[model samples]
Target: MDLLRDVLKGQSAKVFFSVFMALIFANPALASGLASGTSELTAFKDWVWTLTGIFVFLFIIVQAVRAMMDQITWLEFALSIVKVVVVGGCITVVTWAMGVFGVAP
Candidate 1:
């Protein structure tokens, strides 16, 4: 097509992102369309994320307090931080498992 030829020759691709084309692609076949009223969902997700950020700060403070109180060594507190990071990294494994079991479809 002329459009493809134009793109291959480094012409503008704005035609692909025109309003009408964007609306169609944004809806796709998903039940929750990207262009739909998804702000409510995003708000919920953002709140949960905000809570988790606060939790991480509390966790670090608690760990540092324990080190000061001699309940745990500073090295042990560092190891606990590393452990938390490893657990966070494990989410990729769970994601991979879910995909293998067709949860994404």
Candidate 2:
């Protein structure tokens, strides 16, 4: 359990750092003219999507760590399920909104 926890902690930290760097350093200009809506709104939506993906991926990793540690009880599993459902629903809603707004080409 200790070993699994240690590995997961290290890996999670690495993933978090990488995502943070990407968010901070990614080209702002790439978002410009890439979508059809106002540049500010398009950029905000893109950032939201990117951050959501990062968070979901991190949740999956943490759940795997829990499994590895034999710590996935019914409650834990249920919570994970809820997290996935909520994130997926949000993604769907945001995607539809973007389409309806003609934000993406």
Which candidate gets the maximum TM-score versus the true structure?
Answer: 1
Instruction: Tell how far residue 4 is off in model 1, in angstroms.
Output: 65
Q: Tell me the tens digit of each residue's lDDT in model 1 across 1-105.
A: 977787688765565567457685676443466544466566777898689778877998899999999999999999978977887678668878999999961
TM-score between model 2 and native: 0.45
Candidate 2 residue pairs that clash:
none
Steric clashes per prediction: 0, 0
Per-model TM against the reference: 0.49, 0.45
lDDT score, candidate 1: 0.76
The superposed Cα distance between candidate 1 and the true structure at residue 10, in angstroms, equals 67
TM-score of 1: 0.49
lDDT top scorer: 1
